[model samples]
Target chain A: MEKDHKPSSTEKPVLQKVAKLFLYTFLIVIAVVQVLPLVWLFLFSLKNNQEVFNLPPLALPQDPQWGNYARVWTEGNIGQYFFNSVYITASAVILTVIFASFVTFAITRMKWKLSSLVLGMFMVGLMIPVHSTLIPLFNFFLNVNLMDHPLAIILTYTAFNMPITIMILLGFYYTLPRDIEEAAIMDGCSVHRLFFQITLPMTAPVVATTAIINMIYNWNEYVFVNTFISSDKFKTLTVGIQNFIGQYQTDWGAIGATLMISILPILIAFFILSNRIVEGITAGSIKG
Target chain B: MNKVMSDKKVIALYVLPAFLLLMLLVYIPIVLTGYYGLMKWDGIGSMEFIGLENYRNLIVDSAFWRSARHSLLLAIFSVISLIGYLLVSLVLSGRIKGADLFRKVYLIPMLLSSVAIAQLWMRIYHPTNGVMNRLLTSIGIEQPPLWLADTNIVLYSIFIPIIWQYAGFYILIYYAALRNVPNELVESARIDGASPWQIGYKIKLPLIAGVIKVTIVLAVVGSLKYFDLIWVMTQGGPNGASEVIASYMYKQAFTTYNFGYGSAVGFFLLILCLIITYIIRKLTATKEEVQY
Candidate 1:
């Protein structure tokens, strides 16, 4: 009996090792699948049309053409579009965070008769498809002479992002102990002062999280900018790249370079703030 | 403290700016979208009130139905893919080495804008010089299919990237949820001689049922409203074979200048989303949420 048990135990250990090996391979394969396309994109970006067609798909660029990046930046409106995206994304994220914080503070901290009702309105705003609002917004922007303006894009980003930003902030706000705010108030601090100094400071971690999320959304937003701002000067990278690619449609390296530049900022931000971005995405979605 | 917190003046100052923006932009436009559906107006022209004519045409529009069907197919595909994501999450959440690195690597694609993703994929699907065909030929399959140009498979081809973009997001959510399941419960089940599969399927999944439900709703509604990728990659193209609801609405309003018809379609999409959300919630509502 002891000899039989020993063989079985040894076999079990071997089988478990095999299973573990299989699991790791499975995971690594998925990781490879996810990153390979981007890898190929980066490789192709550094190669000219000849190298791109001649070389293997994953082959390293024999002579990396860094000029592709320079040409796209100088020859196209990519610089202007990049600047527009940066400012638009920054402005919208700032506005969304501030407004969301105020509303969140008011609902979670302040006593209000219609607090729940008001909160419900913003929450339901999440379910309203942006498509439903697109035409009216276009008309509204046209009527108000803001059709081709950057302000139109900024305001729309702020409003559309408000619900999700507030949602992420709400979770953090609810968990915050009101002790310090109450004590500050007991010392005769005003509501505005309490919010600005006490509550807002305490919620900075979540504010950072939501800000990154909003930056991603606003940076990547396509349709509203595509519709409202048709001019090259005001177009964000998403739309700008669309038109830029149209001109350089046959120049694989140039188109690849342009696409890389557009996505690089977000990718850089992701590498730096991945933890916060992950936390933000989980927080924003899991509550649904 | 109560008086300071409840100050009507301060509260109004704090809330009114955001609240008014929400109303002006989101809520008001929704009402206007429905109202605009009752009119005959080419965006820049004077409106002629034509009650329900657009809606009537929408009912008989084969193109709209086809797009709606494509949207539904996408929704189904997204829901089915959730199972694969969940399986991957279950594996990742297990005591695996380098799980964090694996998870983040998977998330890289999700960070990209749809336009960039669409452009990158168009090159991937390029008929003559694409990575896809290159790999196919190297593997000795000479006749690789034209991915986006083929009307028969365009929708399915588009669905692959949609799945790729969202896989990490769903996995991240599930991993977080599965991590939240109490270790003691899992350990106890293991001590009771449960197999690993049983431990995952029987114990972990049931506990994260609520998260699973939310993901289903997200995947479905998100698929129904999926636009940017399809718009960029195919533009509902190969003869409209890949059109989804949002892309179709976009085409009607922005491209074709059929403002009235687009609004009607847009209104229908809004109602469909809300109703589907409500129904999924109702169907998946647990009698009592499992408490640890």
Candidate 2:
């Protein structure tokens, strides 16, 4: 009798089960919508124009054209653009992280009269649209003879990204205990040594977060490079791929291959450090 | 402690490099943009003093106003879509399996560059051979509208990919906010015979109002200045159907060599962003917020 009286009865469980199935279906459909285009892109990257139009969108090509990737890489100045993107991305990330680190440290750790004002400037810098500065920057770069130069792109990236990088680092810096600094000062450590040997290492995790975020931004950056760098040798993948696709308008496979190559690094990074990427993006944007 | 931490030289050494760069690149250029608007200069030529002529012209410029209207429409669409994102986050924040994996998958597009997304979507909308047309035709539709070519539908078409790119971001924010709602509040509410719908609407939504407000501001401002993807996909083509303020500014300064006019647009954009940001912040502030 007691067993029959249980609240976990047959009817309620069945109803809830159906609801759960419906909910899961809804979630899965959205996931598919988000991913389907990229899957289609990958599918066609291996097919010639004939297979692309003749076969179903999802069907695999009978003979995969692996040479599409090789041809574009060798013939389209992509190799040069790839390295340019790499070193420039690396340079900007390193410089922005370190420079932003220095500023964040001084603002949070060191005592200064104008610290808050200086920090306010960087924070306000966040809201200034990049386009507003483009004309003047173009003129400035041209005047300085830095137009079409990689350093122009690299330095501009560093300055623009500093605010958000510092913003992310600022939170982590504030949360750190003062005991380390007190101990370091007692041991006769100078400011530079204390920062390099202690504070910087301690903030490694957040640094890594900022570094990845900066890398993504720099690697994918188009406008500054598009506006400032005119020569192909200095162009990054984002801009280079634009020009490449223009020339290969009819070659769907090559265009697909080029797009794939442009995005592969970011995809790989996300695979490894997805949690950090998610955390960094959230910390950076939500705070604003 | 003050003596050790307040060294002027150390502070200057640390702060000046980044600060100067910000001034030179970010701050100074903004001021110069406004000043540059007062002159008539081709990008390569000397300036002629034009005073308020460009600004006056902009007041009546139908092309500029049309672009502004398109941007405003995008902003409205973005704000509306936030509701759908909120609903998804609410569902995911429930007792579900594989939520983490699903959110990560949704973020894949966000990770790729706008250029890549643009190039990929161009093919996906490739009128005849595109996946969209193929699917429609397979399902026995005799005709499907040309997406990017039709000016009437083109803006809305572009909005789809923009929504796709940003859904995960807003969902992730809402999901995080929802997760922070205390479980005890939810459990007690449930024990009191409140339905899931009631709890979600009354309890969960109110608790996350602050985050919702932030996302509203972000979405609206982001749409107002959107450029990269639009530039690549349509180049504001099919008769400037999808042009936004940033792209218009680009076309003027870079393409048409109308530096003075472009600078006017750029200055207007800067002021517009700041003013809108301030207005939104003021409007969204609740009475409870004022107490602090």
Candidate 3:
């Protein structure tokens, strides 16, 4: 191989250096491509329609209209939507993480007869497309008088996210040492106490990962909220931003601001907890 | 411990809430989707038994078939794009600088809502003022194409953003899998006078074949059922050039109130996803995987 490539060693180093530079340049270009649009979005969010249309995509506004954010917040239902998104996302995440933890604990720690069957059902739930369940769910919610209600959206998010949530938790739970459970049960700790006190606390790190995953899904979920919750008051930011954009279709700045507002929470969460997000996403998908 | 673990009442108490929600919401609705495909209902009206009429119409429904074909195209595109993602991952997983930062930077788009992504891409593809045409015109090209409005190119336009959104995810997965490839194997191959290309091709690729198979299933199924970006951006428009199955079903049931036919489309999507998933898994399942 060396004879076949009988080039000067110094020349080989130079060649490799050029290749390395090209590779880095390629990677950096993709990174910029990924980030540039959002940066453009932010730039345009501070510019009026004239500025947006006249100026370059990457240009800064002459006077940054911080007012776009305030205007959208004050005029549109954005504030209400933001509130709704927060509480609903928080509620769904809490419920999903808790419910998923309970089920995962039961499946992993318990010696139930039909554990595998029940677990299989939940696992199968992972593959069932949300679109297939849409019409029936809408009809079911309407029949039960839960349609157009926040609870419908909340409960649906919980149900749909349950499979993946449990899937993430299951890996964590399986690795949990049974000795702690044995010690607790040997001390006569009730099963509920065991789960809530020892097991749940022990699984807190994964619970947080699953919770973040669920939060992202619930926060960014569109179809369920769009279909089930028709009323403005019940809509979360993801759906509400649609209405916001529709109404302000001509106002480039307002639309940009609305989008920025809608995605800000997730971006903030990512900055704070990217490692967990990365872990959860990788664990959730590859395992599936 | 066994007594506590096997307590049926406790088990039921622990699992029933999540399990029942799955049954009532996810499981039951799927079954009902198939059942509703057999009935004639307008979402508000009483169901009248039609007995596979909807499915039959779906068979001849050229529009629906067109949408299905588009979905298959997206699936193929997604699977093909995996090779690109794998290549990038292979490069990133090597002794590259700032690989961690690059992976995360590439992931920024995946974190945003599809609504935001779609809307942003919509602006980016705007006919006159958008970045795409602007760049083309700046480079001395005349009459840059209208991207999202062109029936011939709308699907590809939408696919670019889809690729952008998911590129990080696939790369991250592949990078992880590649990093897990035993270094000793590569070292031994290197000592045996294999070139770098040969080492990557012959050694690293085979080691991560399992992950690649899983991703193929993911990308295909994911593309087949993709909705948010398409719905938000094109809504299967420009004379239905980019219509995928989910968006078609959505429009039928929600916009047209054709619950029966929509359910048929939805059921078809469900069956297609499941069948493809099962087939891919079976086809990709290795002999060693079975032994385990």
Candidate 4:
């Protein structure tokens, strides 16, 4: 029935208010659920073993012990691991942009014969799940003495992160208008300089998206961190935190404490780039 | 011929570095993972060839089938809830003021590490004095099941956080697609006396079927490879109640160090992913590209 559609006046206001009430209440509940684990994480972080497992779980600390963070930092070497993650993640992001931007230029501007072929090959990597590749990559790393080396994961992360990065930059660079590019070409800018100056600046938003997304992946990564990196110094937060879960016995309080500390970057990133991050993920997936 | 040759080389020059890197990390390993299926290697010693034995045994391995079933179940539940919730969220996004805030709350979990999210869910599902059970009892329920610990509910329990975490991504997808629909169509519907719900179901949904189709496909693919959450929450445990294919394969390769068996499962995963994605690609894609 293509009966022409319209909003009925009588029910509209009532429905709108009811919807508003439901939505506000729902948001309040979601906000609580969203933040509650964090609250539990912080609360447990301060409690001793007795209080952690206490019935009616300790809502707040009777005694606020500041030592758990220290233990996780010193004994856990979370500080060292944090630095290692930052170092590796920084290198990986830089490498990803360098390689991906070059490829994007070749495909979009250089009129390379293998442009489509190159993209097709990288696209294949996206379909093959990580489980299939882990063992061989592990052996390759082992044979090369990259076992527990941050560089090993950095190399692989650059490769694994490429598929999505190329997907993004390819789309972004392709969509760029041609007259400005021709004008730049007339100005004696080389292909490389064109990318860095005119073309690159134009794609700044996408570059930000790619870099932030890659940083997040490298920060929270577990399987690669656990597999290739064995030593304490090399262990990132996810792997380092797992140490608290085992060997002698699990320490719930310390585990919670470490978890609270671990999510700080994500929280800060969310606070700053919440809209951009959501938009990036959706745009990359839906369009690219 | 020279012109064509130079053109090809230029393309090669551009894509070669990225392409070669992928070959090392992705292609060779996948080939090896498949190749190892025929050889019984313990990952430390000489690889002895026993072609198809892993697959033969896998056929009889009840645990493998059980894990596959769980993966399939998780896939179904996640796809249904994720798509359903995202659509509802999209609709609410239309009507609700302060939608940006709701979306932010939803997306916080997605930004954090999967391990962090898992640990969060573990607390949510805690047996005694967990937030979930506490909420239940406060609302007049006497019984509270140990969520991650209980075998039956464990798989579904694992899905809750995943669905919650990922719903935001899908909402963004639908929202973007909704935005692209010409305002005239929506305004016209309003002028023609259709209810908001009617306008959505009739005009909006079918219009964005392509995006919805994609959301479905991604949901399926993402769920199949789902491991991080399952590994963190329950290492396919409490009697292997929540074993996805990836986690089960992980236990073999890393935990038990059975490289050959793990490789065989990895091949199976490859084939499964191919079949699923191929079917989806075929279904969603039209012969002629739809240009807006």
Highest-scoring model, DockQ? 1
Docking quality band of candidate 1, CAPRI definitions: medium
lDDT of each: 0.92, 0.91, 0.90, 0.78
Which is the winner by lDDT between candidate 1 and candidate 3? Answer: 1
Off by over 4 Å in 2: A1-10, B289-292
Q: lDDT tens digits, residues B2-116, model 1? A: 7778889988988999999999999999999999999898898889999999999999999999999999999999999999999999999988988888888899899899999
| Model 4 residue pairs with clashes | A4-B192, A5-B192, A5-B193, A5-B194, A6-B193, A6-B194, A112-B11, A113-B7
Q: After superposition, how far is residue B177 of candidate 1 from its true place, in Å?
A: 0.3
Docking class of 3: medium
Could you say which candidate leads in TM-score? Answer: 1
> lDDT tens digits, residues A1-288, model 1?
111334546677667779989999999999998999999999999999999999998999999999999999989889999999999999999999999999999999989899999999999999899999999999999989999999999999999999999999998998889889888988988887888898899999999999999999999999999999988889999999999998888999999899999999999999899999999999899886
Of 2 and 4, the candidate ranking higher by TM-score = 2
Interface RMSD of each: 1.2, 1.6, 1.4, 3.5
- Model 2: per-residue lDDT, tens digit, A82-117? 999999999999999999999999999888889999
Find the 10 residues in a row with the least total lDDT in model 2 chain B.
B283-292
Q: Comparing candidate 1 with candidate 3, which one achieves the higher DockQ?
A: 1
Model 1 chain A worst lDDT run, 10 consecutive residues: A1-10
TM-score of each: 0.98, 0.97, 0.97, 0.91
lDDT of 3 by residue, A79-174 (tens): 999999999999999999989988999889888778999999998888888999999999989999998888998899899899999988988887
Q: How well is candidate 4 docked (DockQ)?
A: 0.52
Q: What DockQ would candidate 3 receive versus the native complex?
A: 0.74
Candidate 2 CAPRI assessment class: medium
Please identify model 1 stretches exceeding 4 Å from their true place: A1-8, B290-292
Please provide, for model 4 over A212-277, each residue's C-alpha lDDT reduced to its tens digit, 9 standing for 90 to 100: 888888888888887888888778888776675554135666766678778888788878987767
User: What lDDT does candidate 1 reach at residue B235?
Assistant: 95
Pairs that clash in candidate 2: none
